[model samples]
Target: MTRRVALGVTGAASAAVMSGCGSSEAGAGGNVKQPEISSPIDMAATQDVPVGGVIKANSGDVTVMISQPAEGTFKAFSSACTHQGCTVNAQNNNIVCPCHSSNFTIEDGSVTGGPAEEPLPQYPVKVDGGRIIVG
Candidate 1:
């Protein structure tokens, strides 16, 4: 009986740990109230990003690139490469896809380098308080 109870508890603990993996969204666990899922999800902090700098942020499951072109001016685009949907990274003044060297302008998501003909989809972004909110 003791061994059966120990196994049951161990299995429950393992299940709990596995369930929490690979998710950033707040969960409605028991008495805790989950945050409302709104259209404009709160993204990165404004102070962490500098003028002419870019940062990668997650809006739920979608990955977005947030750029500061000038002081108080911000822009965001889908980080997925237009060529093959691989996630792109911030490289200097351009967003580059390591998969195929596809480069896009930070100011606007226009493709500056080849292999990708279409530009990254830009997201409407605005600064509120110290956070950059994206929809």
Candidate 2:
């Protein structure tokens, strides 16, 4: 009877601990929950980004840096720096990381200067009906 009681107590404790992992918020392990984008998310309008310029935009909790390298061509990448996960800004046709002084190309998100070795993650972008769609 004592062994049965002990087993029951352990099982209850384990179940209680495991329940927190399935929470709707960020996990206790600091893992962030990415927002589900079932369809292409519209980030900005075509006129919002100028030719030969870059712009920063957000879709839900995701930050994106977009560039118009030519008259109508558009490119987009995750704004988070690969070096230390710091948010980068679009400046002077480059993605500049304020935290580590890393720079990435606006056209391809390739590292142009380091501290950072990996390129920024690229997202699929398309212009549809004067709207910029990203995913």
Candidate 3:
């Protein structure tokens, strides 16, 4: 009876390992992937968001930060992090997430430190009529 009980426990453990592996593959197979949102971005005012500046805009379930690292150069990126799907709070010329202490530069949304393995995704934008529109 002891031998049978031990075999059942080992089998259950193996099964659990396999199940965990399967879930991991789903994240790797591009299942959590987000498609590019192509829509008319409402004209958000451009207010001298200078070098190392960050602007937070919420649209639907998304948040965006329009950054200007240098004069006359602007870059917009998804405020969300690629690691744990947490929104990056841009402050003092850097993007920070308290959840894991991930830090990214506001200049280009590039990871500067911590556990983040990938950079933030960028969004396309056009400045017209003194407003920034992201696609």
lDDT, candidate 1, at 53: 83
Error of 1 at 89 (Å): 0.6
Instruction: Report lDDT per candidate.
Output: 0.75, 0.78, 0.68
lDDT of 1 by residue, 4-87 (tens): 999999999999976654233332111212123348888889987779888877656656888998888999887777776666
lDDT of 3 by residue, 1-135 (tens): 699999999999999966653242321221233335679575366674666687776667556778877766777876666766655676677777545677887777788888888988887878887777788
TM-score of each: 0.69, 0.71, 0.68
User: What range of 10 consecutive residues in model 3 has the weakest lDDT sum?
Assistant: 24-33
What TM-score does candidate 3 get on C-alpha atoms?
0.68
Score candidate 2 by lDDT: 0.78
Q: Which residue pairs clash in candidate 2?
A: none
lDDT per residue as tens, model 2, 108-128: 889989798999888888889
TM-score winner among the candidates? 2
User: If ranked by TM-score, best first, what sequence of candidates would result?
Assistant: 2, 1, 3
